[model samples]
Target: MRRLRMGMIGGGPGSFIGPVHRIAAELDREIELVAGAFSSNAGRSRAAGEQYRIDPSRAYADVAALIAGETARADGVDFVTIVSPNHHHLPAARAALAAGIPVLSDKPATATLAEAQELADVVRGAALPYALTYTYSGYPLVREARARIAAGALGTIRKVVVEYPQGWLAGEASGKQAEWRVDPARAGEGGCIGDIGVHALHLAEFVTGLRVTELLADLAAVVPGRALDDDCTVLLRFENGARGVLLTSQIEIGELNGLRIRAYGDRGGLVWKQEEPNSLTLYDLDGGCSMVRAGTALLGADAAARTRTPGGHPEGYLEAFANLYRDFAALLRGEPAPLLPGIEDGLRGMAFIATAVAASRDRAGWVPLSV
Candidate 1:
């Protein structure tokens, strides 16, 4: 298959996610970064193009220029990747979709729920394949877990516990990344909740194939004078009467990307942790235990299809991210991308953020989480 050309919006100097997106998208040789509006600053965007070794003429000053220049060419970008901060996601995507290009964007969809809803309309109208990088859903073992739950390997899921804890924001916000994340205007209403909490929410729903119907939430800005919540605990009720607990915080000192999930059903329970991304553990009611490793025969077809290497060869964040890119590439080719997250997932995530924030702010007890 030919490489799908990709244009990037953001991920300039010192930007963490942009590099990841570039590297991941090109990993399988299915996508290539041909052009980008790497920064809002014209100089930086051009310099970034030079840094990436793409032709200087193709690097544009901003999204408008990128779209205009690229679309004018016969070999224009097949899709654009929006890796900018929360606020920029909507405008960039809107422009790309309007130009008749597909889009693969970073999660949360938009800065606010209203923006996400608007983007949804635009996506539907465009009739293009729009995907979100809900990266964890691409993990081989994560796919394995999802397949097992859906196949009734764990009979009648009763509970789900997903937690994502990071200690980077325990002190006063410092770096460029931290600055925008805590800013309400840039990152939206919920801080930790909108940031990492949405990932946990998506993972839980993706794995169990269950929707969060209602929730009672407690959100706090643990750092003094912070505008948005940095820590949160949400009590969830899934569509199938399964209870869930979602804990995500950026203020937990000593914690480093500790994302873990455990789900229990009548027959068994399964556990998977992001830090140890290779394996999944399952336990039965009578104390029988088994381990399912990535790239192993134990995994279902969905998981096996995603695994790239042998069982012992570890595949971490970038590979999992690349899976989404690969899937998006498949989607652009009119192939089925069953594991990919799209506009609906984006809506649910935005709703998760808006509803969780409102529930906590108003001290509302057990409010319905309408997506």
Candidate 2:
């Protein structure tokens, strides 16, 4: 099998997500990092290329130069991965697609909803394979949960509760990651909500197969002098009439990446947590509860297909993230990929952010989620 070549943007020094993308994309041995514009500074970008051990000649100063250089080569990159801050996602994706390269971008689509909307048009015009790394959806157990819900094991979903909380920003913070996330010019109008809150919202909807139609939100900047929201609570109305609550905060002291979701239906309930990615909990109407472990025989085809190990062995964050890349490889090879989040998911997530921000800012009781 031929390995697809990948070019990256923004995984410069000290970037947390950039290295993760490289590792995950190569884990299945189906992709290779061939080039990148790793940072805004020309010197730093070249240094990062050397660190990745790629040909330093392929390291460019910006997206435009990268596109020009790569597209001119017969062995150019098979796709482009955008790991920059929210603000850079649009231009990078647009440039790659226009140059006839596929795109895989990090979450929240773009800095603002308007940019996401524009990117949608660009993607459609390019008619190429574009995906968003909604990493949790790649977990084996999470796939099982989705399969069970889709199979009617959960009956009619009546309610949902999802949350993502972290304590790193509970006090004063200073770092490349923290700086870009809190800046509205880079992170958009949402802070915690745009960052982790969008993940919770996507997870709830993805597992339950429900779309959030309306929501009432309360957003706050928990830490003094912060320019964007650090905490938020949202009440949701699903298209099928299911109710939901989403809570996301960066100022919760001592907490880590505790993302969890619970959904109840007429016949039962389902639970999945990010910390414990290997197991899913299911409840029966008769007060019976069961745990479904990943790599077990009880899992559906979707879960089994993604599972890499047998029962009792754990597959974690890196593996989960790798699933997306592996499946994307299949997609580019003309194979089926039912769960890959694409431009539409990107649009919906941005709409969620915009709607939540508007509802909270305007004190609107409830607002429709429209892109």
Off by over 4 Å in 2: none
Model 1 CA deviation exceeding 4 Å by range = none
287-366, model 1: which lDDT tens digit per residue?
99999888888878878887889989999899999999999998989899978999999999999999999999999989
Structure candidate 2, residue pairs in collision: none
TM-score of model 2 (CA atoms): 0.99
Clashing pairs in 1: none
Best by lDDT: 1
| Model 2 Cα lDDT, one tens digit per residue, 35-107 | 9999999999999998889999998998898999999999999999999999999989988998999999999
Local accuracy by lDDT, each model? 0.94, 0.92
How do the predictions measure up, each by TM-score?
0.99, 0.99
Tell how far residue 276 is off in model 2, in angstroms: 0.7
